[model samples]
Target: MPSPRPDVHPPVVTGIGVASGLGHGKDAFRQGLFEGRSVFALLARPGRQRGDGSPPFFGVEMPDPPSILPPRVERTAGLSGRAAVAVLDEAWREAGLDRVAPERIGLIVGGTNLMAREQFLSLRDYAERLDFLPPRHGHVFLDTDICGLCASQFPIRGFAHTIGAASASGAAAIVAAAEAVSSGRVDACIALGALQDVSALDLQGFRALGALGAGPVCRPMDRGHDGFLYGEACAALVVTRPELAGGTIYGRVLGAGFCADGCRGPEPNSDGQVRAAQDALADAGLAAADIDYVNAHATGTPSGDDAELETLRRLNLGHARVNATKSIIGHGLSAAGAVEAAAVLIQMREGLLHPVLHLETPLDEGFGWVRGGMAEHRIRHALKFSFGFGGSNIALVFGAPEGAAA
Candidate 1:
């Protein structure tokens, strides 16, 4: 049957990689999530901690990166860039596209902090402490223009961009890449998103904006909710024309829908999220009841969690079990969508629904949150929602591999 949405087309996922607080690459991430692990811990920043009177910022601690890129490019980029390169390389190898012409490929990267955040923060910290000036570094700008930087690094010649629509950035990038492939503009594309290790500026910014919890914990959908715990990491996926790929099929990207609430600031609006989900359903040719699982964008902010729960309740996908990934790996800004999507694919492949960590108190009576261990279900269709600042909301629906029932 033809999908109802005009833009709907079958876009295949050829390769996937995730480097995040959960761990590097997809396998580790899947294991961590299945174990109901909490990757959150004390935010580690040496310069911030050493800086006079700077408060500590909690974040995911990434070990020193093993050599992946050559020495020339390795020294020129930040940790996020390194991670992006790693994932991109992995996807290329996985897809057996190492010999594909660069011009036939495209690159799209989603990020709120393109590498500049870390460099700027470190420069500021160094300047404050030693009154020293940073070197005239052209490489410092590499992370800022992830789209251009990645294209240049990988030598991609087609559509290249960095999307920054808050949390929706990653999902939006996926939509763009899928369109490029479906429209024949490119045979395949790579989408990557990364959030750097938390810095003093990042911590202070969220703190000043009153977005961080004073208790340093992110408890999504918990009755004792406070604010979010900021975390950092990166992820990338290789998307291609479905007919061209071979290997274990994780899931299919059925469709994507994006909407805006015209919101001016950092507050969650249930109406916008609900509309996004509705739009996605319309695109995927599925009813609300078709959704077997939902990976929610519950950020643990008192209002945000409430808003999402309210939205879900109103939408009423009664049979859909829900999991909130942020509770395990704190929100990774632009990286959130891809990470969540990766989590969903892993869950589907393993036939287990990851629990929404720390979601003890139900926001409502009817909504079901995946609590602990894996809930087994023959999930054929799933919805992943990502909402960002400015009321930008995006929803993506992934279905079972081809030949599977709806």
Candidate 2:
């Protein structure tokens, strides 16, 4: 890929909002992330637990949505919908979007099949009386229901839609929003990684496929790595040109690269991952050595972690400090990319890197790993990786905000 034009300034991130197992809002997220907190527990939600009498799965579940949510949203939206609206409200306020023109704002929600639990329960409850199903179910069954909910609650009139790229949906949405802003399609855009409310069926499917872990903990990049522990998170980022930003700029979206492995399978492709990183660096007009930190997409799966490490080695980025956010937060699946992007920005702003949890022995220690505790590091440039099922791979480059300390 060719580099971006010299005169074109990359889109900047001005606001970030996150709802995760750590807690709601950016303050809780930042504190929990920097403190290396883990909240993994047995699946407790009504529809999340397996019904086969097997052992309960372990994962992180998000806290209840705040009571301040509008009554209509609270009553009508599903779990994922409520979380999306809550995060969007936080991001909108923090970005001062109340003052921005309603027609100039846009929304892009990332993720699909987000309301599986809600749908599953509804169907089971209405099986005896199908005609009595709630009217809202007609619309809420579609993933675009999140887009509609956010657009109605917020003043996003420029355009609104949802993007589904398996687990890479969040990063893909961010890249698309950056393009919209950089091309002047919208003054500012909200890229939301909507929560994936997995049903018992989803859990059983993953476990049967050997992709979901059942354990006391999720150990990403460790020699005892087995599989990923599901996590719930919804993250929103406000992207706009630096000059039009309404709040403190967190970082600049210097470049992004996305590609597919062409094979429809769960396995990751190392060559595709390498190409994505190389393309992102090229778009940023930088080399592998220029990256200061890396937020790896290590999901504790043996093959997935190995493939990413090999890609890092192939790109010669072993010198960059690397850590897995999933080790602390578990795997957010479709929301992982955007949530981890928020994690990267938070660490960059705080000048400290979070430690990986349960990484007793790294699969490969050639890379600089932030482990045991927080490490002081001012990141000037960083890379975030997000790979999804069915071969979607995304790489993003983020640079420190202008005038940031070195």
| Best by the TM-score measure | 2
TM-score of the candidate numbered 2?
0.98
Give one digit per residue, the lDDT tens place, for model 1 in 283-402.
778889989899998887888888888888888877788888888888878788887887787787778887777767766657667876667766789999998888898888888787
Summarize candidate 2's per-residue lDDT along 252-294 as a digit string, tens digits: 9988889888858789899999988888888888898999899
Cα TM-score per model: 0.91, 0.98
Error in Å for residue 116 of model 2: 0.5
Clashes of each: 3, 0
Model 2 misplaced regions, further than 4 Å:
1-7
